[model samples]
Target: MNRTLIPLAMALILCLLAATAPAADSHPGWFGVIADPGALTIRNGVAGRLSEYTVAIGDPVRPGQIVARIDPEQAAAQLAQMQAQIDAAEAELEGKKATTNSLQERLERILTRPDALSSGALAEMRGNLRTARAETRAAEARLAQQIQERELTRGKIAKTELRSPIQGHVVEYLANVGADLSTDAAVVRLRSAQPLVLRFAFDPRDAAAPSVGTRIRVQEDRSIGAPGNDTRSHTATVESLAMIVDEDSG
Candidate 1:
């Protein structure tokens, strides 16, 4: 009787301790990370060595902002070369036109003194004037070609810069300064700041969960994101819910 009584007393005490132990309170709704409208991946259309970066992760960005750039040195050199060619061509054209005008004036002056030279000499002067004019025209055509080439070089230079497509914070960086990248390579990722959305799930049995139009506060996960950012929450109303649960998780 004593042994049985002693065992029963110990069992009761253990059961009471277990019952008294506190458990964490469970929230009815599941937690989810806040999402932005969407993320924008900054990329470049040309392949080259990354020259510099204007922003990094957690840095604020705006649409059309110059985020990163590849080495445009080659393109720039080509542009300068093209520009110089255009200038030279233009100068050549001007010089040729001046020569043509001078030749025309001389020919007119020679014609005015018809008795000074024979028909054969006058014909030679007119031929010289025509040749000068032809040369001027050739120079003009050369100048036009150089100008077109310069524009093509300008376009190539533009492709070296990788710009942000959305106003947001920099989220990821796939390439850094001095890194080589292929065409259409991703450089930086930007996320939109305005119009944030929250995605969450709820257990069907958890008393009453949030529904459409239900107001709630979104608490920032201070442990996960940018440091020194405000952990305060913003109020929002639920707009929609998923009708089905994920079978693998459920």
Candidate 2:
């Protein structure tokens, strides 16, 4: 009975030691800085001398807002030339129309007395009538072409002004006033401010568990002894996960 009791006591002591043994230590997940999840680019939409600049770096701008204006003197001069051409064509067209109307009236009068009209006189009037009609048609075509040219000139003039394409803050200014800019030249950079997002990379193993829209916490500063540094924690949604792990970091 004593031997059996000794074996039972030994087994109990072994169980206590196993239960008290410390668990293995694990490393906490390393984190990276968070930032907005979009890119910005500065571009010019028109070609002309940059006459005015209304924005600078770090200035906030709204979509469809005008950021700068180009020198409109050249464009205005072209528009004026087109307008003059249109006016001249219209005046010529009016004269041709009047001439055609007078010729038609004369033809009507002669047709009423066709029997009394001399062959030479009637033939001359008919020839003049044909010429007037032809002139009128030519004038009509010229007027149409001039009108189109005028409109095109006005459109080009409007293009001299530069407007913002998105609601964002100006991150950079690439051009200055008095600079001659060509079409598609870089002018200013825009970065979206609303619905801002933060992005950071994580271990592929941990990233697997987070799918799209998964809630996560983002820390601004990660320094030792900074207990209140995490107060600015932002809740972010997972946008995407890389399929390939970075070899160097892994």
TM-score of each: 0.60, 0.64
Task: Please name the candidate that would achieve the greatest lDDT relative to the true structure.
Answer: 1
Model 1 misplacement above 4 A: 1-37, 194-211, 214-250
Worst 10 residues of 1 by lDDT: 4-13
What ranges in model 2 sit over 4 Å off?
1-45, 194-238, 242-250
Q: In candidate 2, where is summed lDDT lowest over 10 consecutive residues? A: 4-13
In candidate 1, what are the lDDT values of residues 149-229, reduced to their tens digit?
Answer: 888779878988778777778888888689888888888878775456677666544565665665555555675656665
The TM-score of candidate 2 is 0.64
Q: Cα deviation of 110 in candidate 1 (Å)?
A: 1.6
lDDT of 2 by residue, 99-218 (tens): 999989978987998786899988998999899999999999988988888887788777777777777877777788899988888876677754444445444444334466555444
* Residue 216 miss distance in model 2 (angstroms): 11
> RMSD in angstroms, all models?
15.2, 16.3
Tell me the lDDT of candidate 1: 0.71
